[model samples]
Target: MFEFSLRQVALCGQQPWEEPGELAEPPSDLAAVIGTNGDQFRDSFTRLCLYLARTYDDAPQTRTDDTVVIGTEYGNTEALTRLQLGALADGKMLSAKHFPNATSSSASAFVNIGIGATGRNLTLNAGLLTPVIAIWQALYALAADRSSTSKVLVGDVYSAEALLDAKREANGLRCRSGLTHATFVKGREFRADFDFTADHEAVVTLGAQIGSDKSIDRNGAFVTADFLDVIQKLDVGEQSVLTCRGPLARRGALTVTRQNFDTVGNGGLGE
Candidate 1:
């Protein structure tokens, strides 16, 4: 089990789409924050990244050493589809602007650029389990490099286009479209433990320990939102956990404890 401090959390729920088969409008101030004339961030995915990145940038305690890990199941689906359709129809590439957003990692790249983070950056596409997996990656990074000052920024975004794609592919699975961000620091405000198991016993055991009152189950596409709610409601010295079951017989569990800093030391894990 790896552990870290969840210092802050930010989230943006599904934005209104005026029409079907079109990307949602970006936040009004997004262009100003990114220093653009509303041209660079045409796609919803990049806009969402910038919006969340601005949260970290605007924070008073923003750190220079930062790692970014973003997860998405259907990344920039509208741009990718447009690219594919353009290629198939005319045998010509789509607009150069759309080319960069076609890849899954482009959103994360934009986030790194938006926040000016120079440390390690990664993107993952693990379907419904993406958020939990991303958190696990962040915890692992912190645990592996104890002396590193880098704080991990982990997040996931699902656009309306992604939801439409899910409907087309998954026989209307009713996926939610939203974005969430959480920052994990070196000090201990929460302790997250990861588990990879084929059976559900681990989740059951951890669930019992955390209890139904304090635990939240990963029942939908965006469990991070629920996890954030629990964190916000938690009092100092309160503990909670989030559990999920992933594909290929995999399970994950994250235990969070709101530490009372008055009594607890700043050292985490091995220290």
Candidate 2:
């Protein structure tokens, strides 16, 4: 048996300097994450990941055998919007090299290369379930390696400036770096509905409860007892405290505040 007590986790992101209620930064990691839209997407993501790994996860290193998973609904929208803006400005096709950095997988790839991490790497864009699923998947990998240490980095990056004009048509999760909101709701579902104005970014660090017995899929849609691997059918708005038991085990609970049952398995309390 893996005799270890996994506790404490930290999250860092580009949130407003004033509204950080439960978050803290000694020197200003948040400041370093903010920049000219796409220019800082990978920077913010990596810095936040490094900070969380250092502050919360027990195993800390620039490069490790630990696996890394990333999630974001709209990543590098700034790069896309910028390419559009540049084309409009010059009336020409945007350079191909410019948009590759805009791909949703960019951040995770950059982090993997920067840290020289040679373990499993994953990225997702399944809306709200993205973060939850990434965390669950990371837990699965870590649980399987009880003797070794591991951590998960679940975050989001959205260019607030780019979304400002699109907010009216922009359906969900307006303008934010996406670190904090991802952290707050990744594990625990937020019951209240809220709206973001603009020029905001957030980052969230996700950690597993010490002894949860539930096994959650990558998208956090279906959950099961880790030991039995039996899928537990859930209903909309049905809340439950959760636990996990497996190779990567934990004990904790997050209430299922809501579930968006899309045919694509896009299910969760907050999606």
Candidate 3:
């Protein structure tokens, strides 16, 4: 069991998703770019971090000790073995060789732009959120054991080539191409709350409901923008149940809520 609270949430991304015909395809060099391809990844990743900074005014600092990072890392080639690729992805931050050049590089910008730094940096990566949470729980417990205070930062980045790569696979599993970064810090101010638990039943029921109705929510919700509005409606004490695939072919659930904040008046918020 693990729990926390979030007083602030910020998000940024390309909007309206220009029509396919409206945009030119990525260059061939960028096709199937891996995280190990330092230059390409850093350029894209830096732009993402910049967008986050503009939206939240909180740029990423080069902290390698006190922060825990969790995310997905798909490989650049189909020949990459699942075990090998997973290992490669998981070990991204450790290999200085994969880091972009210090001169005229995005990674350099990311390192130089941030003002806050900490000492507990750690990186944990996974293909999905469940494992990310599980890893966070374990690592967080270890941090507590050591009597250390740390924050958890989660992020994910995907490219069009990665999505196309998946479509060519036999399983044809779903894929998303985007960048996401979230910050988690410990505090008791502003009266916020969050909860996560395993609930297999809710996962199945929700999947059925979505499938049968052919919609995620009653408002025919689809796309990231549409979903963002749904999230805004969440209020203190109102729980949001989430389901995800766990390790070794298992199912898991997580429940989230805002506690101690009033959402009844003042436009879905409490004081």
Per residue, candidate 3 scores C-alpha lDDT tens digits across 1-271 of 3333332333333233432111133323332322233343344444443344234324344433334332334422212222235557788433455433322233323423342434433333333433235335533543364313233322333344444543453432223333333334443212222234444454332220111222221101122122222334666556444443333344433444445443222111110
lDDT of 1 by residue, 53-148 (tens): 675434435545567777666655655665677678998855676545667577777777667676678887665456567777777767777323
Off by over 4 Å in 2: 1-8, 13-62, 87-100, 143-149, 161-271
Sorted on TM-score, best first, the list reads 1, 3, 2
- lDDT: worst 10-residue window of model 2: 223-232
Per-residue alpha-carbon lDDT of candidate 2 for residues 1-271, written as tens digits (9 for 90 to 100): 1111223333333344423122233235444533234443343444454444443433335556756666554544555566567678998875666544656566666555655567777776544344335555555565566313334455444345524543544223223333421111122211222111221224321222213442222212223112111112334564344332111122223233334333322212221
lDDT for each of the candidates? Answer: 0.55, 0.40, 0.34
Off by over 4 Å in 1: 15-25, 37-42, 56-63, 93-101, 146-161, 168-173, 200-222, 235-237, 262-271
Candidate 1 residue-wise lDDT at 201: 48
TM-score, every prediction = 0.72, 0.47, 0.50
Model 2: lDDT equals 0.40
- After TM-score superposition, what is the CA distance of residue 67 in candidate 3 from its true location, in Å? 2.2
TM-score of 1: 0.72
**Every model's Cα RMSD, please?**
6.4, 14.4, 9.7
Model 3: ten consecutive residues of lowest lDDT: 216-225
The better-scoring model by lDDT among 2 and 3 is: 2
Tell me, by TM-score, which candidate is best: 1
Clashes of each: 0, 27, 10
Candidate 2: give its CA RMSD in angstroms. 14.4
